[model samples]
Target: MSESKNIEVSGSVMDGMAEKGGVLESPTKKPPTEYTVYPIRWLVLFIFVLYSASNSMQWIQYSIIQDAVVKYYGVSSITVYWTSMIYMITYIPLIFPASWLLDKTGLRVTTIIGSFGTCAGAWLKVFSVPQDMFWLGFAGQTVVAISQVFILNVPPRLAAVWFGADQVSSACSIGVFGNQLGVALGFLLPPMLVRAQGTVDEIAADFRLMFYLVAGFTSVLFVFILLFFKAAPPSSPSAAADLGSSLDSNFLQSIKKLLTNRNYILLLISYGLNVGVFYALSTLLNQVVLTYYPGANEDAGRIGLVIVVAGMAGSVLCGLVLDKTHRFKETTLAVYVASVVGMLIFTFTLDCGVIGVVYLSSIILGFFMTGYLPVGFEFASEVTYPEPEGTTSGILNAVVQVFGIVLTLTYERMLESVGDRWSNVGLCILLAVGAAITAAIQPDLRRQAAQHKG
Candidate 1:
């Protein structure tokens, strides 16, 4: 039976009991009791983290394919841009809706549906395309993106509920670090696999290979979900205590509460712009490498691997710093500042010996680029109330994605009109703005948290 139908029937029975003069002791029909479940919740979060990690390969693999795609597909630079863009556009907007679905249906069903969609999308990429492969890849990515709506937004809320507030940021940071590691490995491995084949077709083979690999990997997580994942039983004390209070909160009120907080709004804008610049730069990095280092003549797979490896280190370092310090704003602002400086180096110092320039820029960019995830989500979590954390997070995720839409359009036009150099300069400016905004809101967010705690 459907979850909604089950809920309705349960409600009717409860009402009938009350009408017959029976005591309505519990909001849920079941008894209030604790469990011997120990710490299964952390295990569940880890599984979900792996699920998110597997999907990261789908997007991050683009960097590896950058040259192969340009060579085989004979397309413009914008082609790789949209491969990442398709997924971003497809997935980011769905965050709010995914959160709403989680509230209504629970994680099991939502995750299953997303997992299936992602798997199917991956399989479709096996065949060659008639038009721009962007649309075909996009169809698969759309599924992954839509699936991600559930995967990305729900986790931190789950972390908050299962692990409690003090551990929330740390748990989240670890999970996100897993996601980046997947991205790193995705970039690192594909080129080597292609090289072993001893032909360009062998390299081309990796695209189809990634689809099957990521799909099969992520599908395994679904089995774990089916076996171990469940709604908190009605008999659980937490469920019983929350039964009435859950009904009392409205969607509109939750939105109003989140928006009215000035600090939260500022953080959202900063994150959105930050993501916009990040995506734009990531998509363009391969082209930048080719332009500056003419002899490097490396495939997209190799270049992408280097960047992803650097990014992996950056993500872990960022998580460790935030977990230890609990200073969300300081961490984010510092990363943004570093990224701005890195973008400048990539643009202005292009003629300096390629190795010194590229290596320094990549290391700095990787270190600063991905660090935003840890602190950005941490900031969002602190601003939101515990109950509505999912919804609030969904909104923030969607807003950042909207900025991605702008970045997509602007990156393409700038790439064509002025050149890669100017396109990057614009990105540097956005990073600077993001840092400024994040820093500005730091004092306000600290004050609000103090007020809420007091």
Candidate 2:
């Protein structure tokens, strides 16, 4: 029952013989088989977009308005940071189980688990926020964070299950766009809804309103997904996608394949560095901005919005480009290097005292940095062809979360001891190292090669 087959990507006999939706394909099937793309695929994608946003909203809900949270909850700034930090911490343990569930139980069951978690977590906060109960609020966030394990890895699988080979990259980006949209609103909503200038009672009232609204929204999403979401279409959307599930059926074996792949290992390291630093920077943006521009709490929130909104555009654009070019390595390296330049500029401009310049810096930084997410996911699928999308995506997400926790702690320490200049400079250096690693990877483009044969 145990096997580690080295698959050839040239439309070999084994490729034609792979099982799809638990049914064996015709033996007469040959290279370049025609595939179907259902209209229902769009509907499934829409449901995914909604809940992905709902779940991702919790990632930065407290971090954007850290000042208000600290005052209302009567906690330290570090305690406020942990509300967001715990998401990364919880993800490490939960991802293994979540991936197992994704492989075993399939998409519908695993997806509903995330929707239920999001709904439950949001409502739980509605109960706790009115009381200024920080522990209860954190408990709710942990539940949401746990839900992310199911949600984050869904995009790649969603794309491959429903989209054609040419459209998979763009579909993956559109899927991730939901999460970035959640983050954009997460940045925009808190400062607009809750103000740090208010009294404790006033702050609690504002926070209460925000929680009730999100809770109601997630409640609606849970019902929608319950009725509509399905695991896969009637047939595979692409030739490569036919083997997507069966090849990854042995979850443990898939892990072994991905961990041992040289290109995948490099992609994981670079992804952790670039994306992890983005996580720390976003979660702590208010802190960084507040240090120099005191009393500009709302301004900090707006800047956060600018960062993600720009990233939303970048992600869509990057995905579209990759769909056409399939230039995985070139695009990834370009984005990573641009992210470093953007970071250095942001580091200098934070002290420039002009908010407009800061906004411009955030746009440049977020566009590529956030955009790099889809590129990384698609590239992972490419480098580890024939591996299940969920397993590959899950491992990629875990690496970033680990680095997210480490880099966040490191940034906090440097911000305290050496001040803003050095803290950001340090992030830039780590990113450069990541860029060099990315440059060194000579990916085989196995998935793209298979597409040509098919």
lDDT of each: 0.63, 0.87
Quick one: RMSD of model 1?
9.2
Find the candidate with the highest lDDT and give its number. 2
Q: Write the per-residue lDDT of candidate 2 for residues 1-454, one digit (tens) a residue.
A: 1111321122332344463223345657553455666777788898999889998887899988988887787789888899889889988888999989887887899999999999999988987875457788888998998899999998988998888877899999999999999988888898999978998788888988999999999999999999898887766777678765446368888899999999999999999999899898988889899999999999898998898999999999999999888899999999989999999999899999898999999999999899899999999999998888888999999999999999998998888899989999999999999999999999689887776555
- Residue 136, model 1: lDDT of 70
- Which regions of candidate 1 deviate over 4 angstroms? 1-37, 60-64, 73-80, 128-136, 194-206, 229-248, 295-314, 442-454
Per-residue lDDT of 68 in model 2: 84
Instruction: Please give, for residues 1-454, the per-residue lDDT of candidate 1 as tens digits.
Output: 2222232112232343456697867676664232112255566667767767766667745544566666656666566667677667876657666777876676677867766766676666655433356567656766665666776666555554454323456666666766676666666665554343235565566565755666677667667767776554333112222332255556667777888888788889888887777666656655656666653534434555555566666666776776566677777778878878866876676547556656666666766677667677767766554336667777877886778768867886887798877887888888888888888884444323432222
Give, for candidate 2, the lowest lDDT window spanning 10 residues.
1-10
TM-score for all models, in order of appearance = 0.78, 0.92
lDDT value, residue 1 of candidate 2: 11
